[model samples]
Target: MSEDAEKIIERLAQDLRAGQFTPGSWLKQVDLQKRYGVGRAPVRKALEALAGRRLIRHEKNRGYSVHPADTEEADQVLDIRVAIETGFAEAICRNAVEADIVELGGLAAEFEKIAINGPFHLLYDANLAFHGALLGCARNPAMVALVADLRMRTSPAPASQWLDRSRIERSAQEHYDMVEAVRTSDAAGLARLIRDHILQRAD
Candidate 1:
């Protein structure tokens, strides 16, 4: 909750998503304190915050560990997201404003730029902002939060394997297509794009 803890939370969350820390690895407070150059209280709070988001686990005696990537679970999460977000995209298309497209376009540009040369954390944050803006056009806040949570469950490690490559350029183009789909009110096209965006793998 403190400023220092908030900073630690962002840093740790970025590393966790970037796969910098191996899945299921123990996260000792002392080690994290040294790594982040913060105190015990901030480290503890950061770990607890991550645990709350299901990014890590807290054990009675063992402090915390990175949440193991569960492939089946990740598949299920992405599956559900495809369903919810496709529907949300259709809803947005039904009554979208020009401003929504403008906002999403800006975020997409930011993401493309960051994904190219920025640190993984910055790219990850930019990606989140792009999706957040896309989700923002929807009617329900609960749906937005649900998509964000499911995304956190997927994290960056699995996706980052390909997303960190030249494939990111392809991904950036998809973002542009998404903007076009929305601008044209192509609901079915938007839905298909959403499904592919979540399910596609880079070859």
Candidate 2:
């Protein structure tokens, strides 16, 4: 993407993540161009990027609309996440060093800290960072990329999950459990923890 188009895409994606646009509402390119103060080219490019991620749908005449929630689709993505993350955890437990566990603990702590006093976006970003850090420990670039793809269309950003502190705490505890399992090089335990952690309160 050109810098102009990338900037527009990022702003559009941020709006999508923040739930500024209602799901299933058609977004006209002309309106977007006006709203973002951009030209037609960048607006078109931005919409295309979002559509590719399935964050928005591009119908022939409809232009673009936010992707509506679908329970079955979400569940399918979550199941794929479980498979990827479980394998990621297994690899991490087998290959991780002490430094890797320490890093994971720190990332988890930062996320829990933000959860307590969150501008929900910060909390969400921290959650993403923490999970990404854990996946990094696996050292398989392919698995990391694959898990990221699984997350693209099924983000919980539109959900009210983060509004519940108890769920956040539970997720944080799961991160700690994963760290412990990795420290002990318990591959089976780590895989189980990863699966549970990814699925908990994730609707």
Each candidate structure's TM-score, on Cα atoms with residue i matched to residue i, is 0.77, 0.85
Task: Give model 2's TM-score versus the native structure.
Answer: 0.85
Model 1: clashing residue pairs? none
Evaluate residue 31 in candidate 2 and report its C-alpha lDDT on the 0 to 100 scale. 95
* Model 1: per-residue Cα lDDT over 1-203, one tens digit each: 23588989989987776678887789999999889887899999999998988777899887898767766777877888888989888787866698888998998888788667766556556666777777777767898877766676776573564545667777778887888888999989988888898887421
Best by TM-score: 2
Best by lDDT: 1
Q: 109-129 in candidate 2: lDDT tens per residue?
A: 887787677655577767777
Off by over 4 Å in 2: 1-3, 117-121, 156-159
lDDT of 1: 0.78
Displacement of residue 91 (Cα, Å) in model 1 is 2.9
Prediction 2 global C-alpha lDDT: 0.77
Off by over 4 Å in 1: 1-3, 109-126, 158-166, 201-203
